[model samples]
Target: MSTYPHFGTDAIHAGQDPDQWSSKAVVPPIVMSATYKQRIPGQPDLYEYSRSDNPTRGVFERCIAALEGAKHGIAAGSGLGATTLLCQLLKSGDHVIAMDDCYGGTYRFFTAIMSKYGVEFDFIDLTDISLMEKTIKPNTKMIWAESLTNPTLKYTDIEAVVKLSKQNKDCIVVVDNTFMTPYFLRPLELGATIVYHSVTKYLNGHSDVVMGAICTNDDELGSKLKYFANACGIVPSPFDCFLANRGMKTLHVRMREHQKNATAVAQFLETSPFVEKVIYPGLPSHPQHELMKKQAKGFSGMVTFYIKGNLQKFFDAVKVFTLAESLGGFESLVEHPWSMTHASIPKEKREAIGVLDTLIRVSVGLEETEDLVADLEQALKASQ
Candidate 1:
């Protein structure tokens, strides 16, 4: 048995043991069989079917669970798939309260797909404790939120939200810890009922795998999610699972560098004349900087800022930072959220929540901070 005593140690050794393999390989081998052989009548091996269980997928799930300090973990085909499976916990007419500034994909899922099934959702600014308290209906079954909201980098008070959920015993406080990850923040330790992640981002760190995961200390809830994942056939492939597990081994190291680069980038952007506003939880200028300090161990590589000139010129001038949609990788990426990641959201509604056209979101990578800052400086000058 492997001991997960610390974050860095657990990230590498959890859910993995060299002695378990017949070949005695140092790393877990990818088990790609669709079905396992039965040893007796009506009895099969550890995994009866790939959809329900696979050795590679199990290792990945267990590793994530251990990292989050949870008893169970469920992996999905995509981040949105995990979100969709989570909605299975709700039935007809069940109410869900989510943050207004959540990821656009989540908003679309809640409003478009889930609403068609007779589920109700209310998008509220979770920062306002009183407003969140007033919005909870008698039928509310879930409180969905992101620890650090996408693009905007707004912080959610997990403790406060958990307290509110306690008022209604049945209400499950589900947190999308995609931005912070287990390296920086473990929502399960903060009293959240569930924590989910887009493994395509930080957990994978290479942007090669598009997967999602759910971790929870609640055994029953974990079982339900696992069942839904099997029933819905939304589970990730064995190969993806293997890749995610490998990626997690270096998560602790990558996160520290990401945080260091992001802090420097945020500071640089804050002083740039071409930059209008910089929003990073690590910076004192952020509205929830102190709140993040209390809730998380460290900030992530994501940084959002507004530019002074034409957005297109700035987007076109960047040489080092790729103009991309996704985040949390080894190479830096920048995107115009209004037209990229958040485009699914109606312009009026998106703007109302502060995702403006001039808002540029940066996913600071492992590059030297000086080079990144110089690239941004030259890009700004060229745009001008």
Candidate 2:
């Protein structure tokens, strides 16, 4: 029997007896078989096929659920697939109350795509706890929010939203815990019924494996989601699941270094003359600094700011910070949401929602803080 360890230790050692495999290897072996043999005709099913379950995937699922304090975890081929499975819970004519400042892809999924399919959704300001109560509707089946929102770097009050959900048992509190990850903020512990993540961003820290996971503490909800995931046939390949699981092993150490570098970078940018406003919870100036301290273990690796000049100049003059999409990896990445990630949203709506052209979002890497700072310093100077 395998003994369980604390969350940090579990990342490295859990769910398996390495000595049972050849050479007594330390890491969990990837069981790539698509089907498992069942001895008896009327016996319980043992992985009838890979589409329903795989040993490698099961190991990763259990590990993630244990780490996040959830009863079940389901892995999907992509982040969108994970969210899509949850969307299956919403029937036609169901109402969804979502954060106004969400990942552009998510906004597009609910507003543009799902609407055509008959699901209705309304955008609400999740930062305001008081307004959230008013936004709830009788038909509202879910309230969606990001722990640390995309591009905006805004912190949603998970505890307050959970309180509101508790008041209304029918409303399922869904949190996108991608930014804070389970390592920092355990949404299930905070009363979130369903937690989702773009495993592409952080959980698969290497950025090599594009995957996502949906977790819940409810057994029935977990079974339903697992059914949807399998029925839809969107499970990740054995190889991808293996890589993602391997990445989880280092998540604890990687997130710490990422937060450390991000904090240093945010501090440097705040003092830079070219910077007008820095939006990082780690900084004292952030509106939700106190709230973040209460909820998150660390402010996380994402940093966004408004550059006080022409957007073109800032965009064109970066030396080291590669202008790219996606985030939460060892390499620092930067992008302009108004053009890149949020292009799906109309120009007027995007600006109104705070996706400004001059707003630069940075995913601080695991590089030396001094080096990252120097790169930014040069970029800002050159932008002028």
Candidate 3:
């Protein structure tokens, strides 16, 4: 057996305790100092500056790395920062293969912005191995995907993609393991060279922090990425790191309840007269249910479905579900990506990827499943 107890134990105990500073305090103290002093005239400081490093941020990095089974982890100001740093690993004229269905922000960043700098990219259905194989070019540098795709909940066969990257020359496999979190899946162990998380979501659990992380087992790449991260100077603040670290402790328990509530909600949607379709990897009807079982320890907390008839009614009828942009919090939220979170994408492109107006994405929370079901039941009926 592994020396550590499973995820639950690691989440609470992986980082250091500041008992030395204050013996009675159970939680790690927020190291708010902007600089750590040099112990002796010529000796190294514990931390020279807040921007480059902080003791609190160090704890966050080590805790996340321990959870992800990575040798190094770096925290960034936001998920976009993490993505931008990863893009630095490639140069002009290099090609990247990305899943057709990913976060709209990611698609926009790579397709619109990165293309200006001469990086080539193609969007293909990652579930189709042959399609991915056909798209690879001589200078392909990376294969990228979100394990459980945003909005649609489509999944990629991570191992298959890793196998392909291994066959290719000088290509690295990267996964945005945000949806499932490290508690449910560790993509690095599944052959991905790197795993990333937008800790703004479930990892922060309470919706208070907005942070991102990049983790890898390769020390050389980690060093290069860290250098660029420091160079960019978009690291998250010390307080945000402290909040995220506190949230991680309850992640294991929170995820389990989130899963249970989500499954209940999905099942209710499956048979509802007002629901046309329900999208969750846990459901047998999902296209990648089998693949999800093979790759993830449990189905995630997000569920997307199409409400019957006009989407406006569904959006208007909900009383408890907040109309919101983000997910993976303790409170449920619903959003229509076509007009809300993903409005930045062109209308033609949004429809092409199945983000129809009727679509509703829910971030199920720890609320009583019955209350949630009843809320949906009433909302759907009232809307009609």
Candidate 2 lDDT over residue span 51-170, tens digit each: 988877887888788778888999999988887899989888888988888998999888877898788898878998888788777788899999988888788888888888766657
Best by the lDDT measure: 1
- What TM-score fits each model? 0.98, 0.95, 0.96
What is the alpha-carbon lDDT for the whole of candidate 1? 0.93
Global local distance difference test of model 3: 0.88
What is the TM-score of candidate 1? 0.98
* Shift of residue 31 alpha carbon in model 2, Å: 3.2
Please write out the lDDT profile of model 1 over residues 1-384, one tens digit for every residue.
Answer: 765388888888988988878898779999999988888967875779999999999999999999999999999999999998999999998999999999999999999899999999999999898999899988999999898998899899999999988888799999999999999999998999999999999999998999999999998998899999999999999999999999999999999999999999999989999988999999988889899888899999899998898877887888889998899999999998898889999999899999998899999999988999999998988777
Model 3, residue pairs in steric clash:
none
- The full ranking of all candidates by lDDT, starting with the best, is 1, 3, 2
The residue pairs found clashing in candidate 1 are: none
Better of 2 and 3 by TM-score: 3
Question: Among all windows of ten consecutive residues in candidate 3, which has the lowest summed lDDT?
Answer: 16-25
Residue-by-residue lDDT tens digits, candidate 3, 157-246: 899998988777789988999999998899998989999889999998998888899999999999988888888887999899999999
Question: Top model by TM-score, which number?
Answer: 1
